[model samples]
Target: MVIFKPKRRVCKGKEVRFEITELDPFIWLQVNSESHVSYSIDGFIIDSQKKINGIFNKYEYELGTTLDVLFETLTQTFSQEIYACASFASILNTEYRIFIWPKDFPENFNIQDKLIISIKPVIKDKSIDLSSYKLVNMSALESGIKKLRGYSFSNVKSLLSANSNVECFLANNTGNPWPGDLDALIYLKSENKTIALIEFKTHNKNTPISDEYIGKYGKQDWRRFEVLYNLQNQLELAQNHKPKIFYVVWGTKDFDNHKMIKIDIISNNKVESTNYLDRPAFGESSMELFNLLLKLC
Candidate 1:
């Protein structure tokens, strides 16, 4: 495995540090230890100033604005030098952007061939220790489920009907056959029962909480809600335990300030009953969400 030493750079007057690692066929790149990017293609260059504006402008009007069309067009547009790009709000609420083009790519290459994007919190603060809580290996869990069922748990219906000893379950369908994975799933170790299901949203502090943003993020939250509801029903039948679900959003200073917004589930997945949490922290021992989860469990 190839590992790059953590390096720091100044972005928009703020210092950002990141690391890169070669994890077998994929290049795992992480920014500030929170925002993660993974891709399988090799020999790509990262140009901060370069933008795929021309491609977007050319296709936005012609092919409609759906990401599916844009990605398909991108796959067909460039051959030798393929560009793969993604921009999202990091867990720290900073704008995390990645744009890379291969020095030479295969003619049959597709951008989504082996790309995985995820976020994880790695805090340097050591004021608290949470050794009791373990992060479950999702891959191993999925493999076990597949082996037992003789097929992948690719849909919500399949999962709702399945029987397993595994308490924490993650939706792993990449094709969106059902809802995608939730942000986090916490289970009771002693009882082997799921306790909490969480969905996270990150955004800049200055960004307004507009209807458009709510519609986009709320849709995702609603999908998670569906999964949680069904999973709870399944658990109630199997183990007589129903897990509580939460939706939380974070801004740039929210983590350090120990604050986050919790969204209450209402009918139609509309954004209402939003409230601030006092001890919000991610991937840390003092994570306030864990406290809430313990209460639910």
Candidate 2:
């Protein structure tokens, strides 16, 4: 009789179970896995510069490897958190291509605001600074505000990046936009060509109340649409861009319940959706996914 047992690989346990792909080709990815890089999870990958740049590392497997094998392999060897070239990655690697996403993903700023950053693949031990990640929900939108504010650039980017497959070396299909020339534009980050259209409504106190608000429930609803149309045209934003028009609605209560209801109807009617941000003190409402948004922002 003969007895034989399998051999275990480095960093992995005794069961040569889950297999990992060889990460030799994507030279850019190697730096992130380096020994020097130190990191922790702040929603997503935050590099040495305190920036969120989406990145992933993939390992290809041979014929013998099974999901069970991969699953078992992943259970061993440790490095719980660190700043790296990708998001939510493990022994997982897709067979085909993946798009390349833009480097900088915004922190606590709304997707509808005038804030943008282009970060590269950087890894460091230190953490980020995010005191300005603000989102004040004036109406019944406290939850929404917190969700929005909680997101730092890294968290926002990581959530999206982690879901997509990483074998093809592809860019983000639903790429994030940067604030456009007018207000803001979250551009689709891919080698494949595409257009972007973004709008930001800076609610400075001085800016007069839009007619849209006053005409309906005395909250300028009509004026906002006009601005939206104008903004869409100026940017040459295609219908697909889903041209968004944000109402920062800053300062003291500029909108009442009746006004909000009217605006809500208008927004629902439009192809591109619209949302509001209000403070809890005024409305006595909880923040919607706003904190979550901020965490990932």
TM-score of each: 0.36, 0.21
Residue pairs with colliding backbones in model 1 are none
lDDT of 1 by residue, 82-102 (tens): 211111111112222112212
TM-score of 1: 0.36
* Poorly placed runs, candidate 2 (over 4 Å): 1-183, 191-227, 233-240, 252-297
RMSD values, in order shown: 19.5, 23.1
For candidate 2, give the lDDT of residue 286: 28
Error of 2 at 156 (Å): 43
User: Which regions of candidate 1 are displaced past 4 Å?
Assistant: 1-179, 205-224, 253-259, 263-275, 279-283
Shift of residue 269 alpha carbon in model 2, Å: 9.2
The residue-by-residue lDDT of candidate 2 on 139-231, one tens digit each, is 212122223233323322212222112201112222222211222222222211112222222232333333233234433545445544543
